[model samples]
Target: MTDQRPQYGELATPEEQRRAAGLPPLGEIPPVPPMMQLSAPEPVAQAPNPGRSRPVDRFVTIGLLAYGLVNVVITGLSYLDLPTVMNESMKILGIDGEFSNFAQGKLWGTIAAALLVIGWALTAALAIKRLRRGKVAWWVPLVGAVVTMAVVSACIAVPMFNDPAFMAYLEQMSGG
Candidate 1:
C-alpha cells in the first residue's frame, strides 16, 4: 500500500510530523496546532510629501537676485550723468531718446531704480525667511515683486521710446 499523510509545508516532511507525534508513518493522524501564524503588527499610516507641488519658489529667488543686480548697476550709471544712464538704457531696450532733457528722466529713473532695489531686498528677505520656515507666501510677496519689476521697467524704458512729454521733462532736468 502507498504511504498517505497530510503535508504541512515544504519544511515539514509528511513522515517527520507523523513520527514526532507518535502517529502512523503513512496515513494515521489526529488534529494538530496551527504553525504558520504571523506575529507582526499592522502597518501605520504616513504623511504625504509637502514639496511635490508648487515647485517655483527657487526660480523666483534667482530672478529677484538678478533684478536687484541690474537695478544696482543702473542706479550707479545714473550717478555718472543723465546721458550715460539714458544711452545705456536705450541701447539695452533697443530704442532712441525722446527726452527733451534729463531732469524729468532722472526723477522717474531714480524712483524706479530705487524701488527695484528696495523691492528686491524685501522680497529676498521674505523668501529666505519663508524657506527657513518651510513655508511659502504663494501670493502676496511673489505677485508684488513681479508687478513692481514690471512697473520699474516701464518707468525706465517707456518714456525714452514712446512717451515724448516724459522725455522732455527728463531733458529739462539734465539741463538744470
Candidate 2:
C-alpha cells in the first residue's frame, strides 16, 4: 500500500504551498498605486474657545442688566411717593371713609410699597450679580423680571379691586 500520511514539511507554510502550486511569490506582486490607497485622514479641526461669550450671550446679559436697573429705579421712585399716591388713589375710589384715619391707610400703603421695592431690588441685585459673573442662565433674569412685574401689578390691583367702591367707580368711569 502507498504511504498516505503527508511529510511534516510538505505544507508547513503558505509560501511553500504557493511555491509548490507554481504561484508567484508575494514579493514579486506589484504594490497598489497611491490613488488606490485610502486618502490620508483629513486633519482634525481645532476646538472652539470656551472663554469667549457668543453674541447672543452678550445681548441677553446686557438686556437683563438694563431691565434690572430700570426696574430698581422705578420701584425706588414709587416707594418714595407711595403715601401721596395711595391717598390720592383712595380718594379717587371714594373709599377714604373706610379707614379710621388717613394716616393709618397711608402708613400701611407705605409699608406695602416699601416691601415691594425691597423685594424687586433684591431680585435685580441677584440677577445682576449672576450676569456679571457670566454664570447666569438667560431665562433666570427673564423669569425674575416677569415675576416682579406681575407682583407689582398685583400689589396695586388687589387693594383697588377689593374695595367695592373702586369696582363701582370703574363701572361708572367706563359708562358700562
Candidate 3:
C-alpha cells in the first residue's frame, strides 16, 4: 500500500503491468487500437431458443421412447414363451434334437434384452444432447436402430446355433 508497484498475488491485466512485474506477454495479443466511439457488437445470428428444445424434437423423443416401450413389452413376452415356441417348431419340422443348454440361451436372451433397452436410452440421450445444442439430430435414431438390431440379432442367434440337428440340417441343405 505504500508504493505504486503491484503487491503479492495481484493479477497483471495490462501488458505494461505484466512487463513491470518481470513477466513476458503470455502470447500473441492484438495491438490495442486508438480510443474511438463505441459501437454495438457485431450482430450474431442467434438461435430461436438457445438451450430450449422445439416441439418436434420433443415429439421425436417421446415417440421413439414409446416405440421402445412397446418393443420391450412384446419382445419380452416372446422371450418368455421361447421354449414352448422352440418345442412346437421342432415338432413341426420333425427335428428330434433338444436344447443342449437352455440356460445359455436364457443368458443370451437377457443380454439381448438389456442391450436393446440400453441402445434405445443411449440413442435418446445423444439425440437430446444434440437437439439442445441446436444441431441436426434426425439421423441418430436410424443409425441406432440399425446397430442395435444387428447386435440383438447376433445375440439371439446363439441359442438356435447351439442345436446340433439344426446345424446338421443347415449343412445338408448347403450341399455339404
Candidate 4:
C-alpha cells in the first residue's frame, strides 16, 4: 500500500514553517528608524565630593582624633615610667626590694595600659572615620568617649583607692 500521510515538516502552515525555521514572517517586522540605528549617547560622569563632611561632624571627628592621639602619647609616657611607679608603690606597701616581682608587675601593667590605650585610640579613629563618611549615628563617638573616660578613671581610681598616701591626701582634702 502507498503511504498517504503528510510529512512531519510539511504538515505546518507557511507562517508556522517560517517560525519553525527561526525566521520572522514576511512583511511582519518593521525597519528600525535612522535615529535608533546610531549608537546611544554616553552617560554624563559626575564627580563625587570627597570633602562631604558637615562642619559639625568635621569638628567632632577632628576632636576625637586629637583625643585619641593624646591618649596614645600619655599612655606611652606612663608606660615608660611604670617600673619606677611600681617600685614606689611596693615601697609604700612596706615591701622589700624584689626586682623580679616588681618587673613582673610592671610588665603586666604596661601590657594592660598599652592594650587599653590602643583599643581607645582605635575606637576613636573608627568613630571619626564613620562621622567623616556622613553617618548620623552619634552613639559611635559617644560610646568611644564614654569608654575612654571609664578606662582612664579606672586606671587612676584603682591606685588612689589602694594607696595609703593618696587616701590620706583625700581625707585631708575632705577634712574628714
Q: What overall lDDT goes with each candidate model?
A: 0.60, 0.60, 0.70, 0.61
Tens-digit lDDT string for candidate 4 (1-176): 98986665778888877887898996787888885667467755433332564656666667766766676677657755665665566577655442233444455556657766766667776775666556653456567757766775465445435545555555676999
Candidate 1 residue 25 C-alpha distance from true site, Å: 64
- What is the Å distance of residue 165 in model 2 from its true position? 5.0
Instruction: Show the colliding residue pairs in model 4.
Output: none
- In candidate 1, what are the lDDT values of residues 53-121, reduced to their tens digit? 335754555565666567667764563355456666555754455335466567677777677667766
TM-score of 4: 0.45
Candidate 1 runs further than 4 Å off: 1-83, 88-98, 136-145, 157-176
TM-score of structure candidate 2: 0.44
Q: Pick the candidate with the highest lDDT.
A: 3
Worst 10-residue lDDT window for candidate 4 reads 96-105
Model 3 TM-score (2 dp): 0.58
User: Which stretch of 10 consecutive residues in model 3 shows the poorest summed lDDT?
Assistant: 31-40
Q: Runs in model 3 with CA error above 4 Å?
A: 1-61, 80-82, 85-100
1-176: candidate 3 lDDT, tens digit per residue: 57876665475567767677687686755655553224336655545552465667656756776776688667755655455555666678777775555775677877877888888888878877877777766677778878888898888778777877667767877999
The all-Cα superposition gives candidate 1 an RMSD in Å to the true structure of: 15.5
In candidate 3, position 119 carries an lDDT of: 81
Candidate 1, residue 85: how far the Cα is off, in Å: 3.5
| Candidate with best TM-score | 3
**lDDT computed for candidate 1:** 0.60
- Weakest 10 consecutive residues, lDDT, candidate 2? 96-105
